[model samples]
Every structure is written in C-alpha cells, then in structure tokens.
Target: MDIHRFFPPHEGISLSDLSGLCGAELADPSQVDRKVTGIGSLSQAGEGEVTFAVSAKNLPDLAKCRAAAVFVTEKMAEHVPSDVAALIVAAPQSAFARAAAILVPDALKPLSFTSDTGISGAATIDPSARLEDGVVVEANAVIAAGVEIGAGSVIAAGAAIGPGTRIGRDCHIGHAATVQHALLGNNVVIHPGARIGQDGFGYVPGPRGLEKVPQIGRVIIQDQVEIGSGTTIDRGALDDTVIGEGTKIDNLVQIAHNVRIGRHCVIVAQVGIAGSATLGNGVMIGGAAGINGHVTIGDGAQIAALSGVAGDVPPGVRWGGQPARPMRGFLQDAAAANARAFGKKERKRGGED
Candidate 1:
C-alpha cells in the first residue's frame, strides 16, 4: 500500500504527518511512513491499508486487522497489539474520515460544452459561473450571479438559482426547481417542482389570528445530495437549513426552517421535518414520518414509517408508532393490547381467565 494512492501529492500530507496532525500516538512510526493504498472497514482492510475502530464493539475485529495502521480510541488503545501499528486518537472515526479523503480520487473534469447549444439569453450569469458541456438552461431560467454548474447539468424553464449556487457536474435541476440564495455541492439531483429556500412556517400569534414572519436565510446542500420531486425546503426564519453531504431526501418531503440534517441521512417520501429540528449523521427517516419542531435525532437513529417523533432520540436506536417509541417497546405494547382484547372476548363468551 504505497501511501501515494491514498494521499494526493498535491495535498502535501504524508502518512507520517497524519500521526501528528490527528493527535495520534503511533505504535510504530516505521509503519507510519509506509504508503497506504486505500481505506476500508476493519473487517475488510488489507495490507497497506488504514481502517478505524468506531466503537468498543469493533475492537475484537480490529485486533485481527491486516492493515498497516488502525485508528483506535484512547479506551481501545490498550487492546491494540504491539505488532500492528496504531493511530491512537480521541475520535477514531473522525480521523478515519479525514484519511478517506486522502485516499479517494477527486471528481473528474466536466464534459465539454458545445458552442452551439441551448442557453437562455435572459439568464444572468456571473463570470465565475462554470457552465459545463451540453448543459442546458431553458427559457427564463434565472441563473443568478456566481453560479457554477458542472457538465451535463440541466436547468429547466422558469427555474431560479440564487447567488453562489454551485451545482456539481452531471446533475439535473428539474422543471421549476427553484433554488435561491443557497450553496449546493456536486452531484446534486434536484427534482421537478422542488422549492428550495422558500419562507419557513413561522407566524406570530398577535391580536389577529396570526402574523406572518419574514424568512431571510439560505440552504446549504452538500455534495451528492438528492432532493426529490415536490419537496420544499424552507429558508430559516433567522438562520439557515443545512443538509449535510450525501443526504438523500425523498419525494414530497417538507423541510422547515433552521433544520440541520447531518451527513448520509435518508429522508423517505412524505416525511415532514418541522422547523428547528436537528438530525445527526446517518439517521434514516422512513416514509410518512413526521418530526416535530425542535426535536434532536441522534446519530444513526432510525425513525420508522408513519411515526410521529416529538421528543429527542438517542443514538443508534430504532423508533416507531404514532408517538414514536422504541421499536421493541412499540411492538410489545401492540402485542399486549391484542392479548387483552382476546382475553376480554373469551370472558364475554363465558370462558375462564
């Protein structure tokens, strides 16, 4: 595993430097100089590789890892063998994530743009706006200033892009997918009729029934983010709604203001995330799941379909039911209720308890 493949030569960071930069206490500095070809899970890592032990449960597998270096937490450092080099860090997962970036190849260049192509003349484009080859901006597509588009990305008719909306190469913005005053990373697919950066659901109860509030914030969508059809992501009342990298939002999902969705989160169809709700990384929200305002769903949490989440969810837990509860608890409750109903029916028929 020559380290050159993992870390870009342009980055100027060698495997030897990773130890110091990540606050890792190396077991064998000699191995630190060894080149790493790739990154993988502890169970699958090969020689000249680097992997991370994210939790105590993974320590047993880490012991037998064939990789040159293993990122382990302070608590698990004692378990790491002296023979295998260890990159001891407080947060092994974070360190491993940083290492993965060094290994993965950068995005490829955009396709070539043909001189004679369909482009909206009425569109206001900045000098820095990167229009890739074969990219089409339909009639009345408002490409605002400083918008950079990757190759083969298409903007449909009447679609609007706010300032600094960076669309990745090869992505598509569907018909009338309105994005304003926001920042978007690469490989983002925004479906038709999706309204991004709209006003949030905010109203003050005054002498009248309700008074509307002004929404003045923006949305920040990271790389590889996909927004489905008819989904509406509202701008913050005062702040912003940020969708982390690699998050996939399904069709007809409603995301309110100031919502912070972590990386790799999956939001299924018809899911409604209320204002100020925060979801941690790797959270999976099922179809028709309704998250109440101000809820905090921890990392790796799973919300079942049609569940109404009103409270904070702990990390690595699965929840379900109308008012969301632990999946096991919800199942047990349903079983017990059915049993009680059966017992009542037996008693009514003159059977003994």
Candidate 2:
C-alpha cells in the first residue's frame, strides 16, 4: 500500500496556523509560510519535514537540523537559526504529535474473509468475533463456543477455546496457546509458545519426597496484558491467578498459581514469581527478578534488575541487591566496601607499614 497516497498533498498548513491547533501563541507570524510534509526527529529530519526541541539540551541539535520547520518552546526561540522556520509553541512535543497526524493519514482497510483461509464447519463461534479483511482462522480455531474478537485476531491451527472466554478486538492467539475457561480482556496479546491455564506448581511433602496437589483454578488476564513467547501462567491452586489490568509479562515469565498482580505492572523477561505472590498496582519488576512464594509487594514498588525478593516489599519503594532493600541502602552498602579497605590501610600505616 502506498503511504504517500494515504497522505495525499493537502494545502500544507504552517507553524503560525499550528498555534490554533495546539493552543500556543506564535512569536513571529511572518515565518509561518514554510511548507512542512511530516514530522521527524531532530537527528533524522530533512527538507520538507518538521522536528521539535523539547528542552535546552535539545536546542543545539534543533539549531543544526535541516528540516523545513522546527517546533520550539518560548525560551528556545533564540537558538533557532535565522534560516529555519519555527513552530514556536509552549508545548512543542505535543504540537509535533498533532502535526504528524495531519500529515500522516491512516489507511484503514475494510474487513473481509479471504479465499486462502480455512474454517471448521463444526466450530461454534459468537456473533461478535469480527474477523478483519485478511484474517486467517485455521481449522478448529474455536472462537469459544461470546468471544468478540476485533479485526485480525488470528487463531492458529488446532487451538481450542473454553466457553465464555471474551477475547477483545485484534488479539492474536498463537498456535496452541491454550486459553480456556477464562476472560481475556481487549487487546490482550498471547505469544505462540505460551501455555495458559495449566496446573499450578503445588505439592505436599509426604513419606517419600512429595505428593502432588491438584490445581483447580482459572487464569484471569485483564486488558492489554501481553504474555511473552514460551511464558506460562499456571492455574490457581484454589483461587485464580489474577493478572492486573495493563500488566505486561515478558518472555519466559513464570507466574505460579494463585499469584495476584496489580494494574499496569511490568514483569520483565525471565522474571519468576512463585505461588501466591502478590504485586501491587504500578509495580515494576525488572528483568530476571525472582519473587519468592506468598510475599506481597506493596503499591508502586520497583525491583531493580536481577534482584531476588525473598520478603515482602512496602509501598512506594525502590529495591535492589540480593535481599532487595531500598535503593539508597544498597548504594550505602556498596560505598561502605571501600571504607573497609580504607580501615585496613589506616591500621597498616599506623603500625605494620
């Protein structure tokens, strides 16, 4: 598809005209006639493109930029070269987004079924699963026998859905990503290699070594939650393993049974949360961070990369290191290592030098 055709030449508006769009007063009306095609970064902008300077630090790059026009704050107006046309807005970055929309119009296609697709005649589907124009549903990609899927939700070969799994619009279920007996909110993406709703890791030590415990719970994923490739979420041992709304689970993330995560949390790649671990809202667990079983992380807590969290974390704290204390405490311990060497140096200088 031709992108230029989508954004066919409309009478180009200028920086002075942009002020009304973004609620900014233009410093100079005479400099508004420069024609702008689209928006680009300061480093990559060329003729016919417009760029922005967000702060004083970005002013130097904006000055040397070769774009047709540049968006600048009131304070950075002096740094704009005489040859360049300035958009001159209080919030230049916001103006850039608005301007880019005008220049780059969306080319959305109508939804339809293609000739190269396959569908199972016996598969039951809800009336709301809107398949887009080019979507391919393989044989037996059960649409959950009430699942309203948006355009382009591809169900791979041999994938089955449990009843009442409401998949929102535009979700891609990889080949055999087992989603059963749960509700998947809108725009929730699951990778191909993931195994969802499997039995949890529960066992009781018996006379020999251990005895297996039954996992009889569901995995509830909210809107915009992405399960990475090869990642797995176990079914709850008793209750559900609830992934909070807008939370992102990275590749290879292992969320054990009955783990409750809060909204908008970031669980990075290779991070493992044992059974029944609870993370509060807006929590960020860095890459390779490990949380032990049954611990609760309070709201807005941040775990640094590769940290091992054995105990509970309080609210609004940044934790790092092995045991994962506050960031300040970890830095202090790192600084004190040099103090120990300094103490040995002072003792040797005083006596056994």
Candidate 3:
C-alpha cells in the first residue's frame, strides 16, 4: 500500500539522521547516507521507505522487504538482508513510530474544514462566549453562551459547543460534532459527527414504570486525545467520565457513562465499554469487543477482537472468547472440545459401517 495517500512524504532524510531522531543504531556505517522517503509496513515497503520488525517471527520476511532501511532489534540483525540497511533499536515498533512522527509531523495535525482563522459571519457565537486569539469558528457552527475556547482551536462547520463548555488550545472540534457538558484539554481532536457528553442510559424501575435518572456529570477529555468520527461518549450519572491523555479511540465506539479510560489506550472500532468500566494505562481493546459494566482492565491488558469481557482482567495479559479467559486457556479448551467432537464422529461412523 502507498502510505503517501494518508501521509504524503514532503522531505527525505538520510538513514543516519533518521537513526539519531529515533534512537536507533546503524548496523552498517557505510549505509548511513541512504535516503528514506516514506514509511510503510514490512509487506508493503519498497525502495526509499522504512519499515520495522518487532519479533523473531518477522525476521524471515526481511528477505522480501524492499525498503531502503528497517528498524530491528540486535537479535534480529543477522537475518537482515545485506542490501537493506538495518537500524538497530531496543523496540523496533516504537522506534519506527518515533521516526514517522519526525518525518511526517503534519500527519498529526487535525483536518480543518476551513482556512479562515476567525469566527465566520455565518457562525452563531453567543455574546457571552469568549474566544481567545487565533480561535476559528467555521460557518454555521454554534458556540453557546459562556463557552470559553482557547487560542488556535477550531470549531468546525456546523459543530455545536454547549453552554459553559471549556475547550483548550489547539483543539479541533470537527464538522457537525456536538460537545456538551465537557471540559476538553489542549490538542484534543473530536472528529466529524462525534457526540460527546450526552445523557447516558440511566433508569430505575418505579411503580408507575421506568423512571429516568438525571445525568448531571461532565466529560473530561485530557490533552492529545483523538475521539473518532461517530463515536459516542455519554455523560456520567454522578462523577465525571474521563478520557485520559493520548488515548486514540476508533470510529463507532461507544463509551458509556462514568467510563474511565487510561493514558495511551487503543480502543478499536465498534468496541462498547459499559458504564463505570475502568481501563488502565496502555490497555488495548480490539475491534467489536464488549467490555461489561464495572469491569476493571489492568494496565497493558489486551482484549482480542469480538471478545466478551465479563469480569476484571489482570495486568499485561491477552484474553479472548466469550467471558474473555486467558488466551492460552481459551485455546486449550477449544482444542480439547474439537478433539472430542472429532473422535465421537469417527466412532459413530465405524458403528454404522
């Protein structure tokens, strides 16, 4: 795949210079002058691109890689082809990530709907709203009364900022997105069509029928967070719903009331985190995973795709399947069940014969 479609390469850097930026050591000093033009995966990388291999299993694939340079660990150095330059690092993936940031800084910036730097004439900014210098409010966007937006933030076209909402510097509220009863930190990016701080599903069974419970808590989004398009983060019922710094949430994810996500968590598309669920730092929830309410996922835990998590997950473990047991245990149980089924089928066929 051509990475240029998502992040265009603007400038080329020598392998030596790139190594310095990413804390990688050049395997061969002679190849330091090799020019890297873009970044891609090991399978897709070609000439002038840089890629990385994180494990020994990936080392064999290096022979097929056509990249100008690759980031690898010391143990995998021997498998690197002679023609491909090797940049040794303790963590190949992390080094490649750093290199990408350095080479394509613009890729990190949020998409802007307009080039205009000030409030558009078509926008509806209340008289009581306070916008700092360099704040951009696009056409038809609504800034409610008592809203305070910091400098360099962009409220995109047709977006709505609720009354008393506080947005920090360099934030981007995408087109048609709505944010209410929220406090957003610097460099936060809320993508187009995202709905934040809406009332959660809260009700009590009363004598008459179901009684609605008031949702009065706010949503607090910390610095450098990116909430994806069409994602819904409901407001807390009592305490605040908090999204920690540097968390990247994919499109169509649902974060219910009082969900507390920790720093640098990766929540993939269609993941549903129920109310009061707490995810620890560096936790990764795979696509379509369901996290039950009040569950605590420990730091660095990984939930496999489509898994149903019904209880607390321990730190740094991989879990999968219904109820989300340890991956190894789940795999063992599946294999045993398969073997039993196969044996039973053979026995029944022999008896019929």
Give each prediction's root-mean-square deviation over alpha carbons.
Answer: 9.5, 6.2, 2.6
TM-score of 1: 0.61
Question: What clash count goes with each model?
Answer: 7, 3, 0
Candidate 3 accuracy as lDDT:
0.93
lDDT of 2: 0.76
Full-model lDDT for every candidate: 0.81, 0.76, 0.93
Every model's TM-score: 0.61, 0.68, 0.89
Candidate 1 lDDT over 259-353, as tens digits, reads 99999999999999999999999999999999999999999999999999989999999999989999999999989999999998988889543
Superior candidate under TM-score, 1 versus 2: 2
Q: What stretches of model 3 exceed 4 Å from their correct place?
A: 1-6, 56-61, 314-318, 345-353
**Tens digit of per-residue lDDT, candidate 2, span 224-330:** 78788788898798899999898988888998999999999998999999999999999999999899999999999999999999999999999998989999998
Candidate ordering by TM-score (highest first): 3, 2, 1
- What's the lDDT for residue 277 in model 3? 98
